[model samples]
Target: MQRVMAMRLRLLQRPVRIVAQSNAAFSTKAPEFSDIVYGQDTGVRTVQFNRPEKLNALTLPMAMHLTQRLHKIEANKTVNAVVFSGNGGKAFCAGGDIRALADNGKDPATRHGEDYVADVPKSQALKGQGLGTYLALTGERLKGHEVIGLGLATHYLPTSEYETLVHYLTGLEFADHVPQEQRDEMIHEALEELETDEAFQEIDPEYLETVESVFGALNDNDTMEGIFERLEKLNTEWSQETLATLKKMSPLSLKVTLEQMRQGAVKTCAECFQMEYRMATRMMENPDFFEGVRSVVVDKDRNPKWSKRDITKVTAKEVEAFFKPLDKDQELILYPSATAVTEKEE
Candidate 1:
């Protein structure tokens, strides 16, 4: 166990941020629909999931709205950052509204204008929605400089969304090149979209290089097999705990912490510190955040007692309150120096 644990520790110690630098600008309001609110100022646009009646859970209109917004932001040079948050303080977003989705499926009115609505039978409406059902798919191609997803929605949302879009993009690429009738039979069809997309293809080389560099630094044998062994060891519970700690320890003061991380491989020490502090200040006051933590941790009641139990009841003042900094942050550590010696070396 110790040997296994030690290998895992060595492999997992390197800091790894899951998604790379494709940041999508968040649109606060659902432009196409009145119910959703969009916030755009400076370079950042926040698309607040406003339907509190449904825990800000998404609907088909919301998804279409998001897709259009992302496309608009990507086309605009002025906007560079975006965030996804919920209107009510309770959630960033509650995945998808299964009940609303089921209801929407039955209603032909809302389904009329959707992208895949024509291809799939009315009965299989929801299932035919494809990978775009999640948020990341709509935003992946636009590939903004920064994107931040607040609350529960941040989990696997971006990753799965990107993968799905990439897959379709690859498919479209193959479909474009081959005879229409023969396209489906391509042996490498699964990730063809991902493989061929200019944006996705661009991200892969960088990510592969990053992974290879990290693995090379950790593995003593420096062999292909050794790298796989290291990956295996580091995927255990201990590694996950270490990753969680790293996420918690991240410089929280920045306004767009997740966005900054996604943009590039490196940051100056000063830039990192400044952003961390800014983010921490922004996060200090979100009542929903506290409610969520309490529900999940302190109360153990499993149901969050929220500040604005209803999103419509939520006010701009309350959201503004979270942005107010309590005090000048104390002396803080700057970014990690690339030249700093690794613990493995020590």
Candidate 2:
């Protein structure tokens, strides 16, 4: 009994090492990292957005840092899984840094006439055509349950369970280090466990029904004007609230967003990205976006006096102008050959 107790004490005194030497393969430092915090324990690497005050809103530098880290992790044979999180408990990420964007447009060096257009619609279209448009236009946030129902998130855990879930997931042994045939069997077992998790099984049906209605409204072949007309007829309180919310958004933005979604329906993912690039370039020239950001993000005033007050006032020609391609130098180059760079020797 004395020998066993001494052995147990020695084990307890030793440092807790979850990862083997093979797993500590990547360099921990990044050349420029301010907006995010990165850490690795065992096989789980965590990339957490660090700006709590701003809800971890994305900036170009922050995005580049994340991309670089992901590439490094991919190359490391040690890492089994990654966890993306926010430093602040309030939000994982609130999306892009609209304030920085507004500032860039104000800077003489960066300001092109087209830099005045809002790019929210472009982002939303990629997420889920019409739904993305609606959320972007209205700046409506989704609750945890709503997010799960929309399939944006695979599982929803209450705040109480967040820490526990993190502990459990990080403790899981990666099948990668195991033999290939056993790896498949291990994955099957993990998936089977996930199938029985209460959070996965308990999606809110009411939220899903609401999502379906909103999607149907946004995807209808009619123009933004016609879609609103139908939405106005629905007698439900939710419909009334949605219309009221829509009324407060920039008229030009709503129309442009609706058009973008309609066009996105038939386009492939790559094609949609191309269309978005065109819209983004054109939006920089529009003044409504500047005013919208000034009111909402800069000034903290909810009221924005848009360039166009009513949706009916926004002409088809004005909407079509956003789709026109920029000059070759200004157009977005989507090819990997143009953007790819070899990693520097450490």
Model 1, stretches more than 4 Å misplaced? 1-32, 104-346
lDDT of each: 0.38, 0.64
Task: Compose the digit string of candidate 1's lDDT tens values, residues 146-188.
Answer: 1211111112223334434332222222212345344333222
lDDT of 2 at 213: 60
Error of 1 at 47 (Å): 1.3
Supply candidate 1's per-residue lDDT for 291. 51
The lowest-lDDT stretch of 10 consecutive residues in candidate 2 is 14-23
TM-score to true structure, per model:
0.26, 0.76
Q: Please count the clashing residue pairs in each candidate, in the order shown.
A: 29, 9
* lDDT tens digits, residue span 1-346, model 2: 3433443344334332322233354334563577887866656677889899999888777876676667767666655567788877998888878787778866656754334332333454445444565665566776665566567766565656445444534554544446545534433333333332344555566755564466444446556676576567765787778788889888887878777776776676667766787776667668887888888888878888888879999999999989887777676545564354435312
lDDT of 1 at 253: 17
